[model samples]
Target: MKTARAAWRRLEPVHGMIYFVPEARRRYADLGLRGRAGYFASRSAAFGRASAELVISTFYNFNPDFVRQAVDGAWDAASPHQVLDARYAAVGEALRRAGIHELPNLNEVLALTRRAAEAACEHPQGRPLFAAHAALPWPDDPVLQLWHAQTLLREFRGDGHVACLLSEGVGGLEALVLHAATGEVPVGLLKSSRAWPEEEWADTEERLRERGLLDGDSLSSDGVLLRQHIEDRTDLLTLPAYGVLGDADCERLAELASPFGRAVVEAGLLKLG
Candidate 1:
């Protein structure tokens, strides 16, 4: 088990994700009855909607009640699921029209999620686990949810600048952070957990430094300037679902939130109330 975990850790990306299949299969094959019992007990429902709801519920569990209320308010303002369905349908249809083979069905989505979760259990990382539950028909990959949650948490804590450099997207926690902290896009720091030659690390460091984001093992002056921008851009008072003011505030927030809320829901980051 130790050998397998070490290998998996070495293979996993430092700032990205990994799904270690072979290691997972090996671990599952070695589990005793007690381990099996716990595994099945936790994952038996990783085939549907109930599981998805449970995952979302867990995310809301961490916040103050008012935060949850605010999230609910925001959710109510948007036509939840409609935009998601449209997006999914569009993607599916485009794939079909393009004659793409091996497109995932509901069963495949569930199975893939289960496989990933099983891998996670075998080589557990500190990250949260999500899987497709019985009630949801969509791709309820827990890893994706974990990423979303991590992104949100980082954003809430004013650490979203890193996220912006990690992916190409709109207003991701990282993007928001970078936007607020620096008035420009941040360059990525290419440091993988897997060992690479020192030359590669040196090259990466040089590139990042040249971009004015890093300065010899630290953020450069430009990076500092960016952080200032992030501080000014974000509003801490806007809760997840609820608005800052009373009725009037809620109304105004709802109007402003409708589009973004729909986008988030469509991305499957949040659920409809």
Candidate 2:
């Protein structure tokens, strides 16, 4: 089986940058959005008729008020499909301009991705994040299909992660704290991106430390094991999709996707390093 981290890394570079890259942000701005709030407001509007709270809670997994601030202004500006299509076009254009799409075997990678998605079983109930996305109409072009598939795969694992976290009694802030403690994400970035206040975050850190999950500023041995368990469970949960690809195909997909992923990183799209 592919390691959980490896699977995430291979796909992260492809779709991870949509929210952070200058290209997508500029696209949202061109569509009359203000900043990060506007981008989340516009892009997430694709889930038609869903409340901002639902998007915030289920999809973005960020602070409720932070998401609400964005949706308040974004709802009336454009329909969900319009914002989604525009964002896709703009981001895809950026990739093309950067020659990411020009990579050899581009079609092969997309084809393998789509095949895996098609073979995957339908999203189960209770996974609102995955179910919401799985319900969307498929795009016609291979590029869009690749993006959509990646998006679905992400939500698939995301919903599973949420469930796992909940079962472990880890709420949003604690989840972010744990991730930061493990060095999965930088603490400053997590705090800023999640709109978490300093005092509240410090409190959460204290609680984690008290729980034996943290030792001072870093994760303890138990903390690392817990995180690894969650990740392993997440990988197992996502196996339904990738299992369809089989080990050989999964490895092949990674190999084919690596170059394009590297280009995105080189363009400073994904904030991985």
Candidate 3:
């Protein structure tokens, strides 16, 4: 059982629960739970035409009894505690406009979204909010770009393309060194750099070595991996905050960077400089 569970965990995407929000809302409402009704409504509204079917499905799933109570205002005299369910439903409806759809089983999604919303609310300065929005591309906030970059690095771990890219930029070198310290680089490569000139390459190498790019000898075990990570991240850096990349701009930037840009393309990274 434990092995099966572990396998399942590995197979599941990081935020799988959120993906089924629309279905979860319907299931709960059908069972007479009003706690998330309003929430689902609000989410539906936010998603607009993209998720209209999901929103309507949630509405029809609402408990008939709860619907009646709401229409008749029978719970108006109830204490706050007694009326909490209604409050949640109302709030959910408001949030529906913000793209929070009903999921198939929302316990996890609710917990996740609630925490995110709370954090966003606390900041209210728009930066955190924007970050939250941007986080939609990943499973969760913590995973963001770095996690994606690492995943790409792992996919192309031994490719020479990654190594060549790391050899190019000071920033890339620094990032590789950092990965080395974390054991994300390969150890053998760290041992090979010894033949290179100490005086000419000393400063940059020392800086990267300090950051853990180099071990006692060649590139650290993580050097190649980190190089790949940096290359992947560099491609992302040129992308818009919303994650869109313009082909024309990419072409122009690539042209400007010339061989460097072509190298990025060959590495299968973004075409933009």
Instruction: Give the residue spans of candidate 3 off by over 4 A.
Output: 1-105, 124-173, 185-204, 210-214, 217-273
**lDDT (10s digit) by residue, model 1, range 171-206:** 222232233234243323211212234564466556
Q: Name the candidate, 1 or 3, with the larger lDDT value.
A: 3
What RMSD value applies to candidate 2?
2.2
Candidate 1 lands at a TM-score of: 0.25
TM-score of each: 0.25, 0.91, 0.22
**Once model 3 is optimally superposed onto the true structure by TM-score, how far is the C-alpha of residue 92 displaced, in angstroms?**
21
Error of 3 at 55 (Å): 34
Model 1 has an lDDT value of 0.31
Clash count per candidate: 25, 0, 45
**C-alpha lDDT (0 to 100) for residue 138 of candidate 3:** 36
Ten-residue segment with the worst summed lDDT in candidate 2?
A: 1-10
- Per residue, candidate 3 scores C-alpha lDDT tens digits across 1-273 of 222122212312222222123433443444343443334432332222213343332333233343333333222323323233333343233224322243232233233323323333333232321332334333343222222222222212212233334455434334333444555545334323212233433565676767666775456756656655655654443222112213543233223323322322343332111
Candidate closest to the true structure, highest TM-score: 2
Q: What is the lDDT of residue 148 in candidate 3?
A: 27
Off by over 4 Å in 2: 3-8, 271-273
